[model samples]
Target: MKLSKRLQQVAELVPEGAVLADIGSDHAYLPVYLVEQGRIRQAVAGELNQGPYESAQRTVREAGLSHLIEVRKGDGLAVLGAGEASAVAICGMGGGTIVDILSAGRDKLAGVQCLILQPMTDSDRLRKWLHDNGWRIAAEELVVDEGILYEIVQAEPGDERYKDSLWYEIGSVDLLKHHPLFPQKVSAAIKKIGRVLQNLRKSQGGLAAQKREALLQKKKRLEEVLKSCKQR
Candidate 1:
C-alpha cells in the first residue's frame, strides 16, 4: 500500500516494532503499509464513522492482514485498551479535535510511548495543548503533499521541562529550515496568520484586543524565522 507523503513521514516517526493504533484511520493504509514493511507487528485501525470503518476492514482483509491489523469502530482512543499500543497516530484532523481526543482518552494512553499527530489546522493551539498537558514534542517535520503543506509532530510522554517560545509561532524552524519546501511553507503560514491579525485588529472588544496582541507576537516571531530562512 502506498501512503501519502504526509502519512509516510508520520509512519517513519513511529518507533520500530511498535504496536500502533492509528486513530481516524480512513482506509487503514498507514498500518497496512507499516505491517507489510515489517516495521510493526500489530496495529489497531480505529475509525469513527461506519463507511470508513468498513473501508478500513476491507483494506486489512484485502491485504491479508486481518489477523495482525484489527479494524475497530469507535471514537477517538475509546477503541484502544490501556497498554495495548506503544504508539498512537492521529492524523488529518484539526488540532483542536486531536487535543479533545487525547484529553478525553487520557487514561488510554498509559502505555503509549509516542503520539504522531498531523493537525489539519490550529496547529499552534495543539502545540500549546501538548506543552500544557505534559507532553513534549520530540521531533517535528513538514511535508508538502499534493500541493498542501502538512506539519507532523512526534510527541512523547514527558514533563514540561522543554521550552521553545517559537514552537507555536514558526514550528521547528531550526530543524526544518533547510528543507526544500520550508521557505514556501513558512511564507504561507505567515500570510495566513497575518490575515488573522488583520481581522482581530478590526474587531472591538477586550477579547479582540487580547487576541490581536497574541497574534502580533506570533507574527513577529514568524517574521524573524522567515528572515533567518532567507539569510540561509
Candidate 2:
C-alpha cells in the first residue's frame, strides 16, 4: 500500500473520510494507500485501458480492499456517477489532458468537493482552465521524486483570477513561497523562459518578437518574486 512521492502528495490533498475517484489509476496504489491509512472511506479506481485496468484490479484485490475500493475500466471520470465522489485525483498526466478530462466530465463533477491534480507539463494552461471553469486553486504542493519535480494542485469550487496573466504561468507566489522547493521551482521556470527567449531570438517569424517580449516580462516577474521572497 505504499505510494510514490507524487501520488502521496495527491493523497494528502484528499480530505479525510472522502470518497475518492482516481482517474488513470495505474496499479491503484493511491487508493490502496489512502484506504489503508484510514484517510478515505471508499474509492473508485478508473483506468482507460485493459492492462492498467487489470493491474488496478489486482492491486486492490491483493490489498484485500475489494470491498472498499472498486476497480473500473473507463476513460477519465466516466466511471463515476454524479455526486459519487467527493474528491477526485488525476495524477501523472499532461496538464492539457487533465483539463480535457475535467472539461468533458463536467456533469460528473456536480458534487465533487475537490480536485487533486498532478500535471507532468503545461501547468500554466491547467491553471488557466481551472480559473475559467470556476475552480479556485486552494493549495499547491511541490515535490521532487528522484530528479523530477512535480506540482500538485488542489482546487475547490470557486472563481478567482490571478493578478495578471503571468500568475497563471507561475502559480501564486504567496502560495508557493512556503514550499522548500519554491526557489528551485522559480529558477527552473526562469531557465525555461530563458531557453524560449534564446530560441525566439533566432526566429524569423513575425510573432517571434512579440512572444519574446512577453516572455521577457514573465521572466522579470519571476525574478522579482524570488527576490521579494528573499527580502522576507
Query: What tens digits encode model 2's per-residue C-alpha lDDT throughout 93-163?
Result: 99999999999999999999999999999999999999999899999999999999899999999979897
Q: What's the lDDT for candidate 2?
A: 0.91
TM-score of each prediction? 0.89, 0.96
What would the per-residue lDDT of candidate 1 be over residues 1-232, giving only the tens digit for each residue?
9988999999999999999999999999999999999999899999999999999999999999999999999999999999999999999999999999999999999999999999999888888888888888788888889988898989998875336666675566656778777788778878988888877766999988888888788777778877888888
CA deviation > 4 Å runs, candidate 1: 161-164, 196-217
Model 2 vs. true fold: TM: 0.96
Give Cα-based local distance difference scores for all models.
Answer: 0.89, 0.91
Tally clashes: model 2.
0
Model 2 spans > 4 angstroms off:
204-206
Q: How many residue pairs clash in each candidate?
A: 0, 0
